[model samples]
Target: MNAEPADQIRLLEVQALDSRIAQLDHKRSTLPEHAELERLGADHAQLRDLLVAAQTEESDTAREQTKAEQDVDQVRQRAVRDQQRLDSGALGAKDLENVQRELASLARRQSDLEDVVLDVMERREAAQQRAAELAERVAAVQSETAAAEARKAEALEAIDAEGFRVAKEREVLAAAVPDELIKLYDKLRGQGGGVGAARLYQKRCEGCRLELNITELNEVRAAPANQVVRCENCRRILVRTADSGL
Candidate 1:
C-alpha cells in the first residue's frame, strides 16, 4: 500500500478500468443473447431426447418389419407349393394329409406375420410423429443460435469501444507508475476489488471508510511530502492533498 501520489493516481485509473470491465462483463453475461443461448440449450437437450426416441422406434420398427416380411414371404411360398400339390391330384392319402398339415402351418405363420406387421406399422407411425417434433425443435434451436450470435456481435461492438477507450487511459496512467509499485498495487488491488488507493478524506481511510486514529494520523503527517503513506485501517495507499491534508 506504500505508493506515491503519482502511483496512487495510476491506481485510481486501474480501479476505473476494473469497474468498466466489470460492468461490460455483467452486461455481456446478462444480454438478451444469453437468454436465447439458454433456450437453445434446452431445445438442444429436448431435441436430443426426441432424436433418441425416434431412432429407437425406427430401429425397432425396421427389425420387426424385416422379420414380418421374411415370415410372410416364407409362408406364401409354402402356401403356393401346397396349392400346387392339391391341384396336381397325383397325391396319395398320406400325401394329401401332409399337404393339409403344411397348409395349416403356413396359415399360422401368416397370422403371426400379420400381427408383427401391424405392430411394426404402429411403431413407424409413432416414430414419424417424434421425428416431426424433433425436426421442429432442431429448427427452433438453429434459429435461436443465429439470433444469439447476432446479439453477441451487436453487444460486443457497442460496449467494447468504450471499454477500450478507458483501457487506453488506464494504460497511460499505469506508464507513470514505477514497475515495482505497479506490481505491488496489482497484488493488493486484487484483494480489495481494485481499491488499492484511498484518499485521506476527513482524516478517514476512504478505502475502508474508517477514520485514522490520532497516532497513525500523526505518523502519516510527519512523512515527507513526496513520500508514500499507507492507511493503517484498510492497508490502502493514501494520497493526501493540500485542501484535505491529514
Candidate 2:
C-alpha cells in the first residue's frame, strides 16, 4: 500500500476499485432468487403432505361408505325375513306390531347412515380436488425453483471469477508496495473498519461520501506529501488525487 516514505497514497485507487467490486459481489449474492427457491421448496413440501392427507381421508371415507352399505343390506335382509315369518303366521298380532315397529326403526337408521355416507363422500371429493390443485401448484413451483437456481448459480459463478481476478490484481499490487507500508495500512485498515484509504472527490470524502470540513480540507492540503492525512468525517486515511470519480 506504500513506498519508502511517500507512496501510501498510491494504493488508494486500487482500494476504491476493490471496494466497488466488493459491493457488486455483495449485491450479487443477495439476489431475490436465492431466497425464493427456499420458499418454493418449503411450499412444495407442504403441498405434498397435503396431498397425502387428502388421499388418506379419501381411503377412510371409502371404508366408511362400504360399511354403511353393508349395514343397510343387513337391515333390509332382516326386514324381509321378519315379513315372511309374519306372513307364515309364526307370530301373534302384538308380535307382528313389534316387528313392524322394529323394521321402521331400521329404515330410519339406514336413511341417516346413508346421508352421512353421502356427506363424507362429498368431503372426500372436495379434498381430492384440493389435492389435485396442490399437485399442479407444486409442479409449477418446482419449475420456478429450477430456473431460479440456474440464475443464482450463474450469478455466483460470475462473482467468483471476478473475485479471483481482483484477488490476483491485489496480490500483484500488494507485492509492489513496500512491506512496512503495507503492514502499516493493513493494521490501520483493521482499525478503520476494513478500509485504510479513500480518495478525495471534489470537496468531499469519498470514504463516507460526506463533504470535508473547511478546516480539515485546508489542513490536508497543507500536509506534507510524505505525511498521512485522515478524514475527520469517516476516520479513513485520505489520499488527495488529481482526478476522482464522482
Task: Give a tens-digit lDDT track for model 1, residues 17-87.
Answer: 76777788778678887777887888788788888889788888888788888888988988998999999
Candidate 1 wrong stretches, greater than 4 Å:
1-14, 22-46, 49-53, 174-193, 218-227, 241-246
On TM-score, the leading prediction is: 2
TM-score of candidate 1 relative to the true fold? 0.72
TM-score of 2: 0.77
lDDT of 2 by residue, 119-232 (tens): 877877887787788778878988988898999988888888888888788878777766766676677677776677777789788778898777877787777666766788
Estimate the Cα RMSD of every predicted model relative to the unseen true structure. 4.2, 3.7
**How far is 231's C-alpha from truth in model 1 (Å)?**
0.5
User: What are the clashing pairs of model 2?
Assistant: none
lDDT of 2 at 152: 90
TM-scores for candidates 1 onward, in order: 0.72, 0.77
